[model samples]
Target: MKKTYLLLTALIVFSYTAIAQAVPAAAKMNQFIDQLMQKMTLDEKIGQLNLLTPGGGIPTGAVVSTDVEAKIKNGQVGGLFGVIGAEKVLQAQRLAVEKSRLHIPLIFGSDVIHGHKTTFPIPLGLACSWDTILIKQTARAAAEEATADGLSWAFSPMVDICRDPRWGRIAEGAGEDPFLGSAIAAAMVRGYQSNNLRQDNTVMACVKHFALYGAAEGGRDYNTVDMSRIRMYNDYLPPYKAAIDAGAGSVMSSFNVIDDIPATGNRWLLTDLLRNQWNFNGFVVSDYTSVNEMEAHGLGNLQQVSALALKAGLDMDMVGEGFLTTLKKSLQEGKITMRDINNACRRVLEAKYKLGLFENPYRNVSTERAATTILSPDKLALSRKAAAKACVLLKNDKTILPLQHTGTIALVGPLADSRRNMLGTWSVSGDWHHAVTLKEGMENVAGQQVKIVYAKGANISDDSLFNKKVNVFGPEIEMGPATSDVMIQEAVAAALQADVVVAALGEAADMSGESSSRADIGLPESPQRLLTALVHTG
Candidate 1:
């Protein structure tokens, strides 16, 4: 009994020592942020809650903020995405630290979803390997490249658990199981941020579309999601909690309603659950214009919804001027307290502080460093290995996959040589020109001993309206000058000349990402007809 008492006393002492050792770093961060916030004006404090994007990269929303340079100089911006390259990032950072009144360093971010410049398989594909280590490595590689290009934050590891394949964004997450989703979420956070946010090669991971976005009614993007609290806790919320617990620096609120309230304005969710219950210390940012989107959700006008979001614990507004335009008015109107605004601003500043931005704002912004680091040979090799591991062989009929290099092979489809679709979805920073298509890969692997005949079997879809919708980001689906019938004939002619036919068919990249849910998730009519023609030719 005496020994037990001594052991327990020793354990308590050790725990106290560990806590004592850890508190100073955190206390220092708090102290620094407190001092910085004191120097900021009301407009500057409000500006720290606004996240905007310049029009250089893909705009997920309709509006990209104009006068971005002016905003940064005026201290009306917190962070910027859509801007790539180290030189460009350095220029933006200079505007904030050199020109802004408080000279708070700006945090640059991007959607480094799967892999950065060195693109890998989509998240869903990576999840299929069920190898968390490999998944983590992919994220680590992405962080390395992203940081080299001067990005400090990655909006990644979309952990939404989706059972419905019709939901286009399912490709962006681990598949239907919450257990797997939770595991992958933790791995991703660890990979991106690791044990240190101050590390030059690390990036702050943002676990996104928080709280049951995958449960949208009818599998529609940004649609209503109605579910009981028990169901949400059991099926949908575990992955988010896992990410937060794993040290994700930020969370992005989903554009869905919980308990009939938009998530951006749900205090019970962002605060009561994420903060008080889960003990998540990170900040929360809304999805693209999600704060303003709440107005469309019938909550209120832009000003009212922005106020509700701030009071509910949303730290930063993404590409929406709601918080930038209306938070001051709300504070003046007594709709929200000054403490609320300060809390959000402090959280944003804390992220920058943790990133060691105050010590050296130019930590990752070096063109010389970027030239050697982004898409390095080792990273490209890792991407190749990841892609191979992610390939799921649904079936092997007659052991045909291990094809002989001596045979004439027919590689026929719109996707056969399509580089644009190779990287899949949400790969904003990936250059499709750098992507290796199936034909190119086959020729390289099969060598000159094999004669490879290729044909564009069909346009991805013959439906003009469907093509138009998928082509929003660019021409993912290009209706060729040749008719569908002519395309099928060409594919059949190629197939007849080959010993074996390899038909590559699937949805366009845009057909399976944000705002792209499909009611009938199947092969498009054009691909279906081409497949039929090829089979009938036998």
Candidate 2:
């Protein structure tokens, strides 16, 4: 017993010695960034403050610049987004590391919001699960796929808390409740960033739409938001605070204004609330061209807003060129201090350093790994399970659920057969061809015992203009050559034949995402008509 005790004491002593001698992660990171920043020129410093998307995913506007490659080589571009595939990312990274004067590495980011290659349930759907661990696992799977594809950052975990269903962006957030939103936010941060940003398989998590974006007036997207400090602190702000507490590596400012000031240039919101009050150490990035849009907000011109954003604690300007073109001019005119520029630059560089970009520019990224990791069987299985769990059974009359393995069933609706819309919104990297439709899933599950009848009962909508708008990213909602009356008849015939009618009906995929808000949010006219016909056929 005495010998055992002595050995345990020795083990404890050794563990203490090891821990005490080791440099703290924070201290080590600070040291590395300090040395790196000391050698950087002012131009390179400002360059790090820019985040550009090189035209691949959903284009918010026309590609404004032509010389992206030249910009990277000249140290005017710090990161690239909307560029996927390992070979493509490698080509871009080579220019940054080999051709640039300082040979600094470039961080690659993407909007892997819900999932990367293996699409999961949408954020709102996932929220219904009320399973934080499951949500975290989804983010981890997304990170694995994204990092394999040569990305180190993901613009995700959009924790905006919105009660209004009319606001389309609510699809991208946890619904309505600040407490639930906060839990999901922390889980996502833990999943993406994983306790260590230096890990190869981990991507930095971004907590987004900071400071009451969800309360846009009249549920309009990118509209003004106004609230008392009491409501802001108690209800709207908790999720963002929770994400920060969970160690999110960055924040993205919302497009709307708070307290009559645009979030991109609001010093009180960005500085006092985020930095001083909450003590968030990570950098803040603008939402797509939000800096330039401040002119429309009646804030100022490009130069004025650019300087305003910088002074307000914005570290990265996304797709605006406001900072790239005007920050220098503002500096010369004494409109903005050199210290503000340096501080923003340092924050940007610090994020890269934390990501261990200096240690290995192409960390966890390779053509071989990229090919092997995405859409993996494990990821798909998780997604399937997540989808199943996310479905909240609101009611089941006469124990109707847990359907028999052997039965005649009718799957009728626009969504039941929709391959493109199954992945839902913001799954930009997901290939719809690979998605399993309800018909496919039903048949695969029930096998030969179950006879499944399927029909596109109706178009997602009768409105051609709305269909065109939704189909901007893809043909998620397309009108067939057949008339809507013919489609409804076909669906009614299928329903009459089946023992059980499973009518899947909902809005088109694009009906609930960025800039897709509806004044009257409901099922489209055609699909609703189809449901009515199916009921009459019964």
Candidate 3:
């Protein structure tokens, strides 16, 4: 009987030890989050939400803050996006792991939409092909390049389904089909999070503009999203839900109000629907300054919006500082519980752990590894291949494109020989200097047989009102002094001289990000006017 008692006691001790760090990966995940949170302070909890700008902000210029270095050492930043390249990420990450109190590793993220070094077709245009395998391949390339850059996350596969082309960010997603969107969403998730989240070559994919930003009123950014529960379930929610089901590592809330409430504060949307209904295990992050914008939406002060967002199941705040500033006061005031804070912190830590940041601290980030993968000769070759593949034969009338190699091709317009504008919106991480512009591309294809003439046919648009909105992001668009007729005559004369007038044109980059949206989706009136003149003169 004494021997039996001794055995039972030993079994109990063994059981408790095993339960503390249980086997099976999912159970171990819970244990790891619990252990990490036990060591964290209230300050560190706030730090998780404070996604401070590492490079660029709304005024459209990048700020290389001297403070970012010190802040990371102090455990003030949870993660970073926008800042690319392996060296930058490694420097920032080292400060976090080597200098912070807890020594928690930082997760590096970027807008690796489509492809990273090898630029694929824009998401919207690519989706038109309806080939899931191609989309997956595009995502795979993005993952490879992103991981090569010391990144473990991508703000990509923006799965929002846009019904209207009028929405500027429509270029960033699949168009208007919930069924197709869901499939592509899963494909993207699989591609980005290949093998596992902890793999060095895999990066977490973020399914973004969540809970119906795409269906914004009149397709305008910052507009309201009003749809019945049934409508959402049947149409809008499927792709995001599909992304969650496919194990997407994170989600980004949109900049729109849902029903009568701002999405940043909607518990039914984020918590009940996303967490409880769909069973999403990953973290939820807000759009840029979206939580702060809730104040403008008449949702009370910053504290009130912050409380609302936290209660609604948002895990991280992006650029708002809403969660960073107000959660502690709310906790003291009996507004939010400790359980709430723990849940949020748990989600964020889970992501970092799954990225293998805690294990090796520099797993995918060797300088040599980054050099071998990023913009390698093969990757550049793939970029040209992707560019060629993405150049859709939109209007191949009389075989306009695949232009005759021997003919003189006139690449007329702002984008003709330009390097910067070849990339569309959100190309900050891309090496625009390397892009072969329309004229350059034409020249390369034609060899010395074709002469390419170029001109800025008209500034993005001649209308001053439209020009103002377009120019808000950058100084790229200049309001030309020439009258509409003068601009047209110039383009017409140039076009009439060449065998084929390749009028290089489109919305300039930065017209489709966040709040930089346009009401009119047509070609800028200046370009339209030029095209008309060119046809009439011929």
lDDT of 2 by residue, 393-416 (tens): 989988978888787999999999
Name the runs in model 1 displaced over 4 angstroms.
Answer: 1-17
Ranking by lDDT: 1, 2, 3
For candidate 3, report its TM-score. Answer: 0.88
lDDT of 1 by residue, 280-328 (tens): 8889999998999898878899999999999999999999889999988
Better of 1 and 3 by lDDT: 1
Per-model TM against the reference: 0.96, 0.95, 0.88
- For every model shown, the clashing-pair count is 0, 0, 0
Off by over 4 Å in 3: 1-23, 56-71, 394-402, 447-456, 463-475, 478-487
TM-score: model 1 vs. ground truth? 0.96
Could you say which candidate leads in TM-score?
1
Which residue pairs of candidate 3 clash?
A: none
